[model samples]
Target: MKTADPALQAMLRERNLRIIMPIASILAALGLWEFLVWYNDVPHYLIPAPSLIAKTLIQDWATLAQSAWFTVKLTLLSLSLAIAGGVLLGMLFALSRTVEISLFPFAVILQVTPVVAIAPLILIYVESTFWALLICAWIVAFFPILSNTAIGLRSADHNLRDMFRLYQATPWQRLRYLLIPSALPYFMAALKIAGGLALIGAVVAEFVAGTAGQNTGLASRILESSFRNEIPRMFAALFLVSVLGIIIFLTTSWLSRAVLGHWHESEIKREL
Candidate 1:
């Protein structure tokens, strides 16, 4: 039988350690938190132990799950709209200096203006609460994608660009062969950032809307829990929000790796 290579074994060990360490650390931290809360006889209202939070989550899962689904839908819808708008505008900006000069400042202004400040106005004007919330979320998520994509499209290697020009490449040929690949890395990075921002925007919009009902999102659930002084339920809702953000981040990261792992330096793992 052939012996396994020591380097391969070492690499496997390193990969396993990377995964194990974070899980171990989180478990340890939660254990410590639980012990301290128990030892102090802390009121659940002040700081619920992880166990209590978990129990609350289970107890309230029916209501919370519906709210979670609502929040998820809001986030996804806004993100989709942001992506469509940003990429199309980014492409237009890349293709036309006049358009970029005229419109880029407006994008910058929107980005600098706090969403909270405008959300109220949006809510007031938009007839549909859901559409208003989506607009708010889309505004928050759009800029990063537009900025990154524009930069990426412009970042195609000048040497390769010259070669394409020298060969009299068609516009579509140049875009497909050169520009799109260059823009992909930037787009993926922006996606990770925009994913989180979309969730935040959705939550913030929900808070602003403050529409209370069975159709409400997690933010509304949190608000209701706070109003009732149901601290554990509030914590549970907060936990769900955090979990959703983590899920979005992980999903975007996985997409980045799937798309760019083979060729992109940022995604490629180098053996040391």
Candidate 2:
């Protein structure tokens, strides 16, 4: 029988290691935490063991699920709005340097300004809790996407642009063929960043809104649990938030790779 390629074996080993290492590390940390808590006879209220957290998560699944769905909806809505606004404005900025010069500073200001500070004012102006939360999340997520997409649109090959100009190409044609293509990688990169920020923004907005009522998001649930001295339930809600964050990251990363895998150096797999 032919011998297996050593390079292939090495690649397979590396892939397994990537999966195994994180799982191992997470288990090790949990074990150490559980052991410390057990040895010290720490009160569950202080920091419930992971086992208790798991049980609480299962027990409170119905309530937590509703909140999780609400949070997910807010995150997705905010991210969608951010993408639409970012791409449109980014395209416009690419078309007109003067517009970019005039408006980019405002975008920078929005980025520098804390959404937490802005959220309270937004709540006063926007009567609807949903819309206020959404706007807060959008503010947090919009800038990275706009900046990256604008940079990408401007970064198209100068030679190709000159050729397009020589060909008397219509502006739309140039944008479709050259600018959008050049911007995809950068947009994808920004998407991954924005996804996490969007989740954070949604949570923070929920926090600002506080535990107003039964039908609310995870942050509200966290507040509700804390006030009632349901520490385990609070930890459970917190775990869900962390899990959602990981999901957003993994989902966005997969999307980026899927979009760029064929040609982009960042996503394309190379031989060991």
Q: Which candidate ranks first by TM-score, i.e. highest? A: 1
Candidate 2's displacement at residue 141, Å, is 0.3
lDDT computed for candidate 1: 0.95
lDDT of each: 0.95, 0.95
lDDT of 1 by residue, 207-239 (tens): 988964458899999999999989999999999
Clashes of 2: 0
List the candidates' TM-scores in order: 0.96, 0.95
Error of model 2, residue 131, in angstroms: 0.7
Tens digits of lDDT, candidate 2, 91-167:
89988999999999999999999999999999999988999999999999999999999999999999999999999
Which residue pairs does candidate 1 place in steric collision?
A: none
Ten residues in a row with the worst lDDT in model 2? 206-215
